[model samples]
Target chain A: MTTAQLLGQDPGWLIAVKAVMVFAICVLSTLMAVWTERRVLAKMQLRTGPNRVGPAGLLQSLSDGVKLALKEDIIPAAADKVVFIIAPIIATAMCFMSFAVIPMTGVVNLFGRKTALQLTDLPVGVLYILAVTSIGVYGVVLAGWSSGSTYPLLGGLRSSAQVISYEVAMGLSLVAVFIYAGSMSTADIVGSQHQHLWNAIVLFPSFVIYVISMVGETNRAPFDLAEAEGELVGGFHTEYSSLKFALFFLAEYVNIIAVSALASTLFLGGWHALPGLGFTEQWLGGWFTLIWFFAKVNFFFFIFMWLRGSLPRLRYDQFMKFGWKVLIPVSLIWILIVASLRVLQQEGAPRSAILAFAAGVVIIVMAISSLVERNKEKVRSADLPEGEAPNFPVPSLPNVQSINVSGGK
Target chain B: MLTIQTPEAVMFWFLAPLAVISAIGMLLVKKAVHSALLLAWVMITLAIFYIAQDALFLGIVQIVVYTGAVMMLFLFILMLVGVDASDSLTETIRGLRPIAITAALGFGGLLVSLIGRATLGREAAGLVDANSEGNVQALAKLLFSTYVWPFEVVSALLITAALGAMVLAHHQRSVPRATQREQAIARFRGASLGSAAGLPNPGVFARHNAVDVPALLPDGSAAPNSISATLKARGDMLESTQFELSEVDNTVTEEK
Candidate 1:
């Protein structure tokens, strides 16, 4: 049976159990993700990270959570109290909601009742994920605006614009996946990749775009201009304190995990064993698929940390420009190509002809892109004379006399 | 008779009143942000209704488009325009209020009558068969086949709208923008060259690095200009004398 049908047949008690399981997994993964990010980042920067809490600081996040909860909660006098309280709740809840449709395992036996390890898989499952995430931005925006502070307000506005722009690119990137999988339901998309090649390998461009867009969407480093510390202080959650601040932190990590899981579900093949290791999926009565699923998720999460550790945050204008001028347009063009390819395949085109057609499209796209780049370079060079710096203000250094260390007699 | 499953029926009943009340609150709210939030809530309810009716594709699209994108843009604009900027109740346009009330009533009556008539005329045909293949697939089939022309036209309309926005937002510089060198020259040529080296860094040398501390000038007096005006206004600045060294007597009168 299809995963959705299997999920539908689940009893009420079983559904509740599965719900709790999904929640537990999300929370646990978030804790692990935090520890992993810190440890990984610390190692990258040549520092010891969080080794005092538990074994290798395994329980550090838990301790941090307790500390955050116990700290004094201060409500800024200028803040709109109601929205301030609601914002983090909204953020945290929405992140959890996105996990409802993500399949973590194949059909598994629970108390002698068979069920798929997922919540309800709506016909518009991927769209639902996108919708919830889009709503998730509201939390940040409201938090910033309600704070009644300049930095928070600016942060909120930046986040809104950033999320909105990247969301378009993110949505368009998924179109290619939808076209190839012929479904929007996460389960069906995963099933489509069962024995076939993963969508990441098949639709490589879409995978690349999706990966980029997800980072931007989740407000992770390099694309995390919303809460840029040097610029907007703490960004949207600047006014939040104690548990409220922790809630936003939780929401951020949860969002990262959500997008990672989604990337795995869409591109890496959710719950499916790696290529040539399909037999392992049946190990431990098929429960081992959960491990495979999380392994893929961690792979994406590692990429997030790697980015945070290596790349500097992008300037706001440059980030927005890339999103609008580069990612969105490229994804749009890629969608067109994918749709046309799907049509050609439907019409029973010969493999060689299809391959040649794809190659021609790629070449043309590359040629056009290169031409645009060259034109841009020419314009830039034309704007300035050789050996002359672009006109910008730079203060001249004062002439300093060399200090005599020895007393001259 | 319309048939809704028990769970859906419960959800509809619970959310319907909240939706209507929020819609009313959206109109009555004084704060633009609050109004936007109320409207978002209403839109979410509508999405839930669509989903309950098994129009999953429509429901999700409604959310992603209306609540997520459109309402967000609305809120963004409202925030930019000043969230506290409310319309004056004093009508500048004479008779505008009366005209608006009449129009609203007429529109409300028309919608109520239309929906009532439509619902009373037939039994609700659930989406079971239509969604047998899958709601998204079924919708896609109709959209790509039967409604293709309208879809294309709508897309064209959207593209035109985007282009129009770009055109509207495009501003031509009345004068060429000053280069950095020009700006620097203009700055240096102005009343005083005191600021040519840029504002002094805040805080007294070696003693404190806090932004609230005023820097010590060459004569050992506090430079108020060194500290942020905001900090000064907030009465958070520290006295520079506290960090300055006390004077010492260097006379040889200690010969006794």
Candidate 2:
């Protein structure tokens, strides 16, 4: 389909076709996420990760789902039965709903008809994703709460805090994107990235913030505080077993794909052919965008798996401190800078003058701040006792113990 | 606008039974928190009923603001105190005496009310927003233009509710003053300094016999269930922590 037709041409069945394609994308990507996570994690520990399931465990996630479903289902006697059931349902369903707004390609011709590749693009699609994702945390929160167990409750609270902290940073990161595109809708944002370069080049700081935030958003490693087994065993889904547990697992990977895809679509030229690139011609457009999206998504998936294998899980307090103190403040300042520059650019401020002014302001602020900080540090050191530890909470669980019985279930 | 006449219509059909059932459930639930939750659910279904009558904006806001945010405030308070079904105060009326009488009266009253007000023009007058389409943007414009004063007043209402909630949730040290804490610390420091003379300090007593107790249960031991029973008998409430049985269970027969 020509770009003109693509902009405005979905009659009836085209909508259905696009919806089917999105459904397929979610299912396929979720499978790959499972395989990618396991294989990489196994390699990190010098062990095989489901090499027996399919060729190098290609169908590993599917096989695991089948096995999990067939296993004996157990509900903890103490669990809140209805809430426990509803938690996973809410999580998985909300996760699936995100794909509805995720634009895989611009617009594709479906057998003599043209429509947007996404299922349904709302005017506030980005906010819609944000809304659904925020609500998704309730699934984890209630899962932990309704489990009526100590570990799960702690896990749930940790997850909720983790998601909240990072989501704030994530929202801050997207402010730049919204400023550039002038809309929060995913499709419109993608269309804005139609030129040779995407927001990743123009708004690299925002891009970096978004990358960090998405990792935290999906509960990926180094930030997976909620499901830290060495701390809170199995985290929120500790009590869930069999098929119910599988649903949570499925939701996590699908969310990973969705989050990564969002980062790709927003930052990378989503479906738009690269400058001097041959793959974006009209004949190859629909299929090519699909490939382009997957390539960027897989690149992120690799990073996620690599981090999981490479880094140790952050301490809960440190994890929280990083999100709130470091990520949030930095991203907020970056967004302000971006907005200021954008405002100047719109008002016809010369690029060099704006850059020079921004740099000079940064240096002056840094120098003055450094001098003030030194003075405060000197005073703080003088006031503090020689070797006394600063007062803080005693991190002691009132009546808790860890027990791990070794068995292959 | 279509009226149905079917076999199940009188007993249970469409929104009627759901509305009645949820309303009943809201009143009868044992936990105050769950009753509020049930009340929220009833309001949600009624909102859906409004949507069916084309009041879309009202339906959405009812769920979004009321169910999502306000119900959370109620749940948050419930969680802070950990009140549940077991702590609920039961009523005097039993054996369906009150419920049966209320249901009979309600049924008769509702039937009479429905028969008397079945005409369409009565609802036509009662229907809100006869002048405009009630979509979100339109409603927002109407709110800002026609109801601008009330709109600003609503912000005041929200702020007032927030402050009230904060005041209620806060717990102060009723036993001792803030100055007493500093005084206790100062007395301890003074006592440490003057080791040459053994002196009983009167200022030390001002801290109110504050026992510096270490962690009650050491690691790897089950919490003593006996203490919980002791607390129960003494009319002290449990903290609703994750399962720590008290030490009073073994002493129960002895105490009796």
**Per-prediction TM-score:** 0.86, 0.66
Instruction: Label model 2 with its docking quality class.
Output: incorrect
List model 2 lDDT by residue over A108-131, tens digit each: 666765565777655556766776
lDDT of prediction 1: 0.88
- In the predicted model 1, the residue pairs found to clash are none
Once superposed on the true structure, which residue ranges of model 1 sit more than 4 Å away at CA? Answer: A373-409, B92-125, B145-161, B174-199, B202-256
Candidate with top TM-score is 1
Model 2: per-residue Cα lDDT at residue B242: 28
